[model samples]
Target: MTYKGIAISHTILFLIVAAFSVEPWYFLMLSVAQILFVPLVLKLVLKDDHLIYYFVIPAVIAVSILQITEDSRIDSLLALIYLLFTFIVAMVGFKRFINRGFTNIEEFAIDMGMMYLFIGGLWFVASVLEIDTGFTPILTWLTGIHFHYSSFLLPVFIGFLGRVYKPASYPWLTAIILISPLVVAIGITFSTLLEFISVLLYMIGIYGFIVLAIKVTYKNGYQKSLIVTSFGALGVTILFSLLYATGNAFGIFGVTIDFMLKFHGFFNCLIFAFVGIVGWSIWTPPARYKKLQFPISKITGKGTVGEKILDDYHINKTYMGLVDDMSIFVDKESLPPMISNFYEQTMHYRLFSTVHWHAWFKPFAALYRLFSSRLQQLNLPFTSREMEMTGDIVAIEDGRTNTRAWIRKIETSTIFIALYSIHTRDEKTFMNISLPLPWSSMVGILALQEQDGKLLLTSKSALASDAGIYLAFRGTIFKLPLEEQFLLEEENKILTAKHEMRIFSIPFLTINYRILLK
Candidate 1:
């Protein structure tokens, strides 16, 4: 039988088993979530259509075993098996992330959904084992349910929506949703203040999701109705939750646990989980990510070292510029003369730059400076000296990438040996730069933009664009959790540039450069 067929059959068999078991109504309710809802949502979100579907069956059997058995040893063992399956699912998501990098938010949401399943599994195991989670037994079980539906399914549904429609506020709302699960967990465990704040943010994110849902174009009216009802159900549940949180925190308005289970939980499981699953299953969106087709640098080690290194190696030809033609990226008629000349005839210029490390990162930068020269990679100094940067551009024997190695130096020490190339995605050209390391490489894919007589280049980009800083190792490329921007302008008749790097939207480093014609 096909994996999906087998999974459905297994779920049916468990539903029959749960029907006969002497479990409480609440446990039976969880049974439907664990057995039926999880597999359907897993298959929908994953879109794998393979062995991943088979993995769902074992976890289903585990949950079914939990229903009929009272032996703690057996229950714990079964729950642990279920947790193992969730770990495997999380790894699959991590692999997808590595293959695609951080190019699209929808894919990121899907990956996180897959990863969040592990937390649900952990909580399930904790509940089955009766482990102390700083909450009542019933509440602990409810937390497991929260992670399964709210944390896992909610983001996966949002991700599917993002595949078709993302308004301007999508990323910010997505960020809020992505982090809310953990935030809520922390707040409940420690501080009432944090709990109150997280609920409000989570509510905003959900409302924003509902607003975007209204804008999406679905395949059919049935699908649209199901999706709308799904999010709309969530909107009601979230309101109840906000009231509950406020009651617990500030004695404002009280919402009892029993009231939530009847209304909030009932709506979420029946409408949000069930209806949303059926809605997306009717017409699954195509994955927003594809395998990255760009070439990677083959060069390894500390790069060419010592004087006469170029003389010792067979030279193909020296390059006079980073790119052969500025017109490939921009129209020559539109570009400033200095900007055009700097790209096409870069060898005819002299560069002086002053690097500024942000206050928070100075200590780390100082530590890196101690060993950076030995690596001969990005061996930038800690000082803010406007030192001259000298580099020779040599043609690299990379195949279709047509890469050139720019061996740059400051004073006597090597600073950078960047292998520069270019690639096109969605009809836009990107500057591809790779720095070789031991059996690995750090790559930067920068998109180009021209605005008001200046050139802006950045690793941050729109959806489906290959523009990010990535680390490639063992034939796998994954995006670094950081962003970089370079702005070039002819300020007051001299070619000037500002380079900035940010991690989590916070700037940590900046460098200003002045280029002069020789």
Candidate 2:
């Protein structure tokens, strides 16, 4: 119903980020986790895990073997495994780009983050596997850190900043933020002059982000100190990145590992990771505790150009392969009722409400709520607010070849589905996606026919993998996907689905909801 899903392992990425920075024996293991497991954890968040999960299954055993075995040969073998997985996620990001599946800006930036992770992954394999690359072994190790911090984390945080600031309106600045991370990573590998240019670009991107942070805070009634502290750390964070990039290019500045570990490492691991994981977590609005009610009042003035531009985005996502399956099991007259219920029931829990956290976080959460309460008063510009939420499910009809559906709405409710077939490479393949609209996501169901012909439905194709969430914040930017299901019985009633509230496939809460046209 919404892009909002719970991830039990939402903290997995942050934990990996924090754990590896301090450098433990498992640091080598966690570094790989950042890429392989981060995506897996994200799958729990997005609730869309595919074959990629199966590919990384061996990592659990390999990591365990790694703890007991310190042989370089074994390490190389494990790196090889992780290297293959990294390539897979990188390819996922690439294919998404080619298809233009990053429907919005922050989603687009996160895809780029995947590629940078591959860059870091490459260095990680080289250092751990001890491949005979031209660079010194230590440099390979440092390069791994460089890609993780500068190339990987930089873009990811920038993507978050984009959500907070909405950088897409500023075309030139968005272009710089998007392009510099990759160019700098490539430049580091080949040429000094190129790396220098790339670092300058990278610095400029950071500056742009800082400027936006200040503006968003001041205009939006956000707690100024929190934004300042986070971006201020980011400012110094990128400076260390610049120094490292400079030293690598010129081979002159004595930027020792120890020196970097002390200042660069301390600030980035603490400030960058902490602020990103915690600061932004606090900054973003939580899901609404109650349905967001749009009052019927005198119409406001003409909508802005930005609003119209966003409303016109072309989205062509379909699961046509399942048409036959739907035809075989679904009752034709049930569609309108099912759709109506989906439309109304889901709206009750629509976006900007809550981030369910554990009881212990109350004191800290109270402080955050104090800030959030104030910020809500300010009508600061948010990209999500720009897009139109009004939608229509025009018709759901019985057709010769398949059931016809013409629908358009925001996110999962995108009732504006045009006449297009979402072609997949295989019959059962799942698309790697993260929708940009609030309370929106791709919906697919696995339908099975009972002996009596009653249909049973499940959200995922299989229980491919599972994640353990050590943290569940009530209103954290709801991401994780849930293990949910739906059913159809009577023609006029539409569909019967256990609208399960979940994080990381674990149903924390649920409701028996019915969608009906009447």
Candidate 3:
């Protein structure tokens, strides 16, 4: 008999035993069924006398273990014995069938049956174990299908889908396996017969899409763009699902069954599918076109205010330098618009000027004043002319909006500069400047200067108010540096600096610079 035939025979016997539920009678019957398969498998292996003992001795030991073990462990022992017997029988049968070079549907069916029996037997044994199955909690969380046996149903269903569709490539097979958990989770989360039916339909659709994708890929030699686009889409969908789940967990979004039933649970899948199709079209041109060229104009665009802000500070340059050394980094483009808007606002107001003043104003003015007794220490360069007048410089009259007024005060500027030096192959100066501003008031500056280096770029209104100063500063200092770095360049007689500002609700300033060769 073929391996598939042996597998089906074993499955039928196991189901009959399971119907009896690990009783002594069921154990006896299982032993008898396994013994019947052992001799048949041994006879098949005996044709090769050189390996006859190697195969037969193990089978004998397994049979002995099943019959002699009378404890509660006997159920597990019996399951193992059954698996071993079925595997050996199937292996021998498969070898004999392959030698005969069979290519008919019957042989294929037999092979599938054998695989099912092997997997089913192993699953049954695992279910009987008292130790925690790591996946049980996840499965319980997903489907409410608490029965240990039900866990095996998902893999079996997936197997059946694969068998029925007969996918043309490994990627399609992989996708089906990968998406199975998501399908199960959706079904459980929705918790209704209709939702279960919807999951079934979705599986069918996914299987069809995979089959079509595989066909297209085979016809076009595995399009790289399509693969990348598909994976990208899948990634986005997973992220959306995670977000939605988080929202539900926190009682913010209120978990809804309709999301799964009507919209495939998450928005990412549809987005990915659309992208995959578009990417496939781009990667594989029609017959009318001899060659395809991606339009550079379509891929690139004019700089935005946020990009401009990043460019001004040499943020991008710093990023590129650090990216080689660091594993984690942030993308300036991904910053929220509100935050970027605030940064741009801060730049326009020259917050970095205040920062420079905070660092250098007091010490330099004190030293200069000390040398020239005629000079007053308080009359430092760029000190606000209206220092004595301190209240409500800006106000709002609209009744609908909060009637908050900007308050101002002048305090002695203490210059604090700490420097460290390390020997390196090239002489480079790295400077970081920060200033703490009044928590309740907006801060602005008069002017900013870089002594030896050209002002390659200047920030345009970057604002960080009291609410979130730490996050704002860390983000601005760490992320904006890279973009600013890329925008600095020298042309003709003038050195140019470019910067981008991202606004946030906090108090902070960051200035990036690079000196040009004279």
Candidate 4:
């Protein structure tokens, strides 16, 4: 049978079981999810045919058995099978996410939705086996449903909506929506107050999604209406959620779990999930992710060794500035004259740097310095001794992404061979720097700012700035948990600068620079 045919037959069988089952009609909620909603969503987000999805058939059968079975061991084993299917789906999502890298918010949302299904599957298993999950079995089952819809389906829907039209507030709103599921779970497990707060956050994100849905121009009026109705259903159900959360937090008995299951769950599944699935199926928007094709540093594994064996590209060995013109990237009018001049006429300046390794990371730094010195990469002395930096600037003839190689050396030992380039996205320009490593590169996207006559560049920027440190390997880039700040100011006709590096928000190294016209 075709995938669609099987899904329809499985859903029908589950509905029949629910119709005749003695009690626990809520199992019907999970039945539709296992057989229909999840498959449709996987079809949408997954770009290619995956063998893992075939497991969904057995998973459907397992969920069907759970709906009518009274045997404890059988239910547990069946739930385990379903959980394994979800685990496979999650792995597929994780692999997809890694291949694409951290580029688009819409795609990220979709990928995250795929990964979240495993959590839903885990909770489903726990609910069936009667695990001591700190909550009653009913709550546990409800939690599983919560993840399937809110964590999984909602994100996928929002992602598809984003492919159609993304508003300015979409990223922030999506971020809140993405993180709220975990926050809600944390709140439920620990604090009522937290649960209430998370519900409020979720409500804001869902309402924001509704506003965006109205703004998105659909293929036809019917599709738009369906999409709007789907979001609208969530708008109402989220209110129910808020009410329930408020009651639970404050000891109010107005809204109960039973009321939520009957009303909230019904509207969400019928209107939100079913209608939304049909609506998107009418014309699912094309994926927003395009694999980044910008050339990475070909020199890998101790760049000094690889430098001798260059790629099939022209490299003009010359003494040049970091940038031909600072005005091309930022407003030259706002920048300090010395700062602007330094970049435009970089070779005319002499560089000196004092490296400071933070106390907490000195030991690691010392160990790395031993290996790094041999590779002539990021090799800074442990002591805070000022060293003169001398290097040659070479222009790389890459028309797509105009780049330069700035090889800096401290007394004959190569410290950095940073390939500098510029990337413009959404009308904002970023400074892209790549340092070659073993079959990979450390990439830093820096956002520029002029503040109080000083030039401020940071990997961590405010919203709208695609600025972050990342690691690129085999055509895929992923964010690294690191931050770097570079502050430059002109003092007494000389440009002084401080470069601070941190990992997980803890300072590890700093380089103070003094630049003078030679």
Candidate 5:
């Protein structure tokens, strides 16, 4: 008999059994009939291997036995029977009905079987735990017919349609159908107009599928199989719609039918219908056998190896590695000349420089005596001619340098009467310079020196004071692939001479650095 006949007979039998009075003997007899009839029917109608028949017969018997037994202690046994029945039916349908070769059939069967078993097992666990209301009425209906939800019957329906119909011939139509349910579900959950559009799209998808199915049927002679399937689909769709409408119109158990009802229940039926139709088209190619076309290049953009590396490094975190490789240098000869000029020019502007030599006390004393004699002849104040300072360089790098200095100025200074000068990195030029205490307090400067090519830079500032306390700082920066070197001349070099002082304090520090290059 055709699938439609089988479905009708099963439904009628179930209804008859459900309506009649509960009798153990009657159920036993009915169960026996179910166990015997399914194999007989399969043997007569299906042109598959006898192995399927062998497995299916035992599975049906097991399901029947489980259904006939009412002891709660046998619940695990019942669950096992149900799982077995589901597995065997899935195997038979995929292997025999799908006709995608035995390999594909076996794979699909195993995949679907595992999915059904997992779902069923979860439900069984929930039942045992008393976490959920055990098996719904639909599930019980399948059990009554010695079948389970994972039975071969649904797959057969799907496979039969695949063999007969081509519903996914239009890719956009298939996509719309698939996306509609998801959109509707979102809309219902959020209660938005967008969701309503999803519902509309879902309905459109259903209409499209129906139209496609009808067209295929008409074009290929209204074959009995297609006619029966079309009727079954129509019936199922209408039943689902009605159930959803009724549930929404009147709340179940006085609980309002919310987003789930409107989107999931009302719209999902159409979505499932679209899925079935799409599966059909994919499984059974069109008569013309047109190749499936796709733009692989468009999906994946063009990129060479170097381009990819550059893009990845720039776009991601790799640039930090590049920054870590930089180094800095200070042109020592140029620094003293720059400082001498700055002191002379800014002397009229109330700025002065001081140098501290803590390690070379004797040399510093001798130099200080010579400077003092020269200054006395010029009639400058004793403080102006003398300087004392000490500090350590904190951080030095290619782009920037930093230093801290502690300085003490004599009370007899001819310059502004400040006891100390604050040392800081000059912001304007890449250099370290000292300013009087009051001048340093009024302005702050951070000096940075960057060299592209052939550029000698000396930046002095009244602005470096705000950066922090620094006694003295000096550094230079140059790129890789150095070309030439210059010697340090004694006449060109100007050194600062100052008083010697005992080391009073020192602080320990930890430094971390990294280098990167492309």
Candidate 6:
């Protein structure tokens, strides 16, 4: 669904839920809202991407309905169904890890994200079913909230930053971050000593991400603001997390569940989850954005090794609009001899996205879709962004998105492409072939391929052998062999295309579109 669809529907649900909510229901309501907003923020706008909205919108609406009915039996049944859904998503998360191969910083972050989601799901199930694992009712629900909000963002905020910023240089700190959430979960259920250790690790992870945020910067004000607000909120979120966790393990005074709820709930929904998710949705790759605090005299553009290699075709055009009628334009003068065969091929585009090629890649694929939401819509260096919270989309024309001249060649089942994006302005980016290896050390591939009777095309980047030294030098860490698929496909009939990138074989950065040509 479009951004407006998500916004209007959720607003109605929030209002309906609010009307029927009773005292403690307020906490659940807020938590649910935060959960709903989490992906929206991740989507950089209130977008109802299929994976999330299909489950969340229905679940929330059903929740409102059940709450309105206020029947005990129905509530119990809904709780069970909710548990089942949680189990499904958990399974999906597992499949994602296996596909991503767990070797990049983003994958590590994704691993933790899945862990948090699964564990948080369990907590939610327990709270709803009223299954006592030995805590007060308020505490039990609060724990669920903790898992939902804090645990959810543990990976998301870090992962979001990791997507753009170079990896952290501190290995020990990176290890602590990768495992701290698990340790914290285990600490809560198992031992006080472990819990205490987890608390320290937790503080390290939160502060660590904040430091990373400060170290990295963005050209887009939207992304920069999210970096500040999400981390700033997380700084406070962690304090409360530690406070609440310690209270659970060792009766700390003045840190009761009620005390934390009033304070933490607002921040969780508004500042941390809401604000941070909004930022995640507006994410622009760090390489694409300029950096701050760099060595001034010798500073260079943030082009990845891959980007610098493919710079010739990387034209930045100004009029990237769809061809409403047949307007065949090709610069045979600029064409590589290898791809001259398909110069006259012009057809409409039909765009769609699925889980990445492998099952394990789905989770990451979903993330890539969220991160590169705008680029998918217009397959150039995506420069459009949504302002925070107001649902006002701010469009900046940086490239001509319409393909003027298109050509393709396949060798040994590998595809190569070159196309011109026409513009009134002479700016052009010849990027849809193989990436030019930008000034930054990022790796990406731009090509067209056919697999299983289908053609998939676009620029893609997944961290593997290429990013090892760069990630280490930047102080970021993660498992390797990760994939990011920012795709556009055109096999038959209507063509499919996107300005998207997936990390860990998941949707890391994307925007999507369809074209109807005459």
* Pairs in clash, predicted candidate 4: none
Please list the C-alpha lDDT of all candidates, in the order they appear. Answer: 0.82, 0.46, 0.32, 0.82, 0.33, 0.47
Give one digit per residue, the lDDT tens place, for model 3 in 270-350: 333333433433332221111111111001112211112112222111111111211111233443322223222321221
Q: What is the clash count for each candidate, in the order shown?
A: 0, 38, 50, 0, 22, 85
Expressed as tens digits, the lDDT of each residue in 1-518 for candidate 1 is 44367457856776686677767766766677778877777777655557876677788788887787666567777898899888988998888887877657888988898899899988888888889988998889888888888888898999999999878788889999999999999999898889989999999999999999988999999899999999999898888898989998999887888888778657987899888988988888887676666777766564433223334332578889999887777776776888989988889999999999999999989998777777777888789989999988888764436677888899888998788899887787888998877668888888887878888888885523788888888778887778999899986668999999998678999999999999
The reply for model 6, stretches above 4 Å from the true place, is 23-26, 29-31, 38-52, 66-69, 170-175, 240-253, 284-518
Candidate 5 local lDDT, 1-518, one digit each (tens): 43344445544544454444243333333343344434333433243445555555455545444554454676566556645654565455444323322122222322343233333434433433344344453323322321212122232232343444534343344445434434644554455456445545655544554555555543334343343454345434544443443444444323232432333232222233223333332333222211211111101112211112122212211111111111233333444333333222322122123333333354545555565433321112323232322111212111122221212223332221111112222322322233222112111122333232222222221222222122211211111111111111112333222222122112111111111111
Cα lDDT of model 4 by residue, 160-271, tens digit: 9889888679888998999999999999999999999999999899999999999999989999999899999999998888888888899785897788889976798999
Cα lDDT tens digits, model 2, 1-518, are 21122223424433444453434532543444453335433343224555666655565445445444546456778877766766776787665444433133565665676676677778877777778778887767777766666555555555655655564444355568778766865786788779888878867867777777677643244444565666677688677667766787787676666666567655665566545544444444321122211111111112221122223332343232223223333453444433333423432222221123334544554565444323221111122132333333222221212222333333433222322122222233221211112222222223332223334444442321111111112222222345544443435444444433344444543334343333
Structural similarity to truth (TM-score) of each candidate: 0.91, 0.45, 0.22, 0.77, 0.32, 0.52
Q: Candidate 6, TM-score vs. the true structure?
A: 0.52
Residue 439 error, candidate 6, Å: 42
Summed over model 4, clashes come to 0
Q: Is candidate 1 or candidate 3 better by TM-score?
A: 1
Residue 323 of candidate 4: its Cα lDDT? 77
How high is the lDDT of residue 512 in model 5? 16
Candidate 2: TM-score?
0.45
TM-score, cand. 4: 0.77
**Candidate ordering by lDDT (highest first):** 1, 4, 6, 2, 5, 3
Candidate 6 accuracy as lDDT: 0.47
C-alpha lDDT of residue 240 in model 6: 74
Q: Tell how far residue 370 is off in model 1, in angstroms.
A: 4.4
**Off by more than 4 A, model 4:** 1-7, 20-23, 47-50, 302-347, 352-415, 420-432, 444-470, 479-514
Number of the top-ranking candidate, with lDDT as the measure = 1
Ranking by TM-score: 1, 4, 6, 2, 5, 3
Q: Residue 278's C-alpha lDDT in candidate 6?
A: 64
Worst 10 residues of 2 by lDDT: 292-301
